[model samples]
Target: MYDSFRRDGVWPEFDRVDRQLLRAAKVDVAQVAAQIPPDLMATDGPRGVPPRGHDRMRLTVAGIACCEGGREDLDLFFHALRWMAQHEARHYPEPGKTSVKVTRAMLAKALRIPARDAVRLRRLSVLLRDERWGSVGSWRSTDDQDWSVNVGRDVRYFRRVRSTDDFIAATTAWLEPVTVATPAADLPGAASPQSPAEHGSYVDERVFDLVRQSDGARWDCTKLLALLRELDDNYRAGNAYAAHALLRAVMDHIPPLFGETTFAPVANNHPWGKTDGRYMKRLVHFRDQADDVMHRQISRTPCVLTMEDMPARAAVNRFLLGCVSKLA
Candidate 1:
């Protein structure tokens, strides 16, 4: 990406003053001075020295985006993916055939994300393979030795940019993670998670802290933490049945926090927002679905449940908050 801008005479560089200011702000001026294509950084003179001429010392736009894009790793990864599509993708006669074959080694080189980061790679690969998110048509399993994805039809436009502005416009679709619209009952503002694991994220961060700090003085939240962690993992892995079972476990486990033995009383009697109350009713419906999943035998026509059968994160989180507030 930087090379493209450099060739167009639009590479953003720092002047002597800019470097000085960055240094004053405790930025790693020396590190910033290093050039990419690794070979240049190694063969180039001492790190952090601007070239003799002022014209040759511009900061790359890639550097600016990395520092300011909020999610540095993801932003850099997105750029790498875009760069690969634009410059390296192979085109075929059919739609959605513009694709790039990538190995972990290739990704590590392009995005600076280490090939050994299996958890991160797994998370990212799940998103990339999802049609609703990355719009990928197919990919080898993350466990595959040479994992890669076939970019969907959208990549055709993703690579057709005539100028820098066009490139920006083309790739802006990735600026925010895409989510499939749920029913209006979910309350649009309630369950907005920015992470790739789109479901079971409503188990609050404070719950984790509470579990970590668990002692005899109050309650043991370790079981809750385990279930919540599994819930999140199953949801991200698209294991809908396990996720539903774990969610049911979560609802069963937390009732004690409300001084009740079961979730039914809390759902039926707890004070929550009017809309949240409506959603909680949906959660009650979900409990029946959970029963169907747990007790029903497979007949000639089995009743299979999916992620859609789970209640919205909003309802679950609201119920959780009610219990947590009791702790205060």
Candidate 2:
């Protein structure tokens, strides 16, 4: 039924929406959606099935903007969902159909809610699973206490359909290309790459907390924070040269955590897994690019490097996570 919702872009069954969880007198998602302007709602075309046989409506990108703006909980819940999706790819016990294992504790940690307030996870999950809202898969509870949810492969709904201004700004500022590779449309099951702003937000928040808690040299923590902030600023400003130089600075500064003085030895000698090692090699290559950006003399020809030369967000996060682990 949830799968049908994904395919048809309408709730397959209105009976599924828990009225008690929604805390509304009437369990009418369609009524709420009708209140929104038709321009903001999903098109009543082929995919947008009519609200028949207890089916409810799905919102458009603009509709989501209006609804989420008023509902902070909905916005933050989606943040946790995105974070869970990333974590599903990152962590061990590689996920299958049901990926994220969401216990009250885990959800609380993800949302930074106190344990006492953790009951809200149930309500949050209900709202997110609603077709008129997040439009994700159904929640399957494990052990009657924790829920396992899948991010799923069909992510058309996950794709950011935004205002023209927001789209242009995001593309110009946040699109840090890891390479001049083939477009995603040419690759099978390939989604667009994560933007720097998307992944960096988590790193920034986690590292800030780590810095506050760290017993390491205060100077080192301050320096690390400053470098990370500047790298992010350069990315947003589309200053690829400054971003490259700052990435190198980060590489040069954090080797002590891996029981090494320089990044080369850390890459070569650290007993991390092959995946992490691959990222380390990529960073090493990025370091070389940074050197060129900082020291290369003006040439007769144009410089070939652009923002496309920036390292992958995952690799950068892996590098910083290593530092974070050691600091924590």
Best by TM-score: 2
* CA lDDT of each prediction against the hidden true structure: 0.56, 0.58
Candidate 1 lDDT trough over 10 residues, lowest sum:
37-46
Q: In candidate 2, residue 24 scores what lDDT?
A: 58
- Could you say which candidate leads in lDDT? 2
lDDT of 2 by residue, 13-117 (tens): 544443432565655654554464665554333343434334454453334445523245445555664555445444444445434344556666877876555
Clash count, one per candidate:
5, 0
lDDT of 1 by residue, 1-328 (tens): 2332323323324454346556778665445555454322221234545433243343222333444332443444456546445434333435545444555566656666676665455434433443122344556754634567645445534433343344456657655577786654677555434223445454644454444445334776667778888887777766777878988888888877777897777777888769878877887778888888777887899565667667777777776666556654
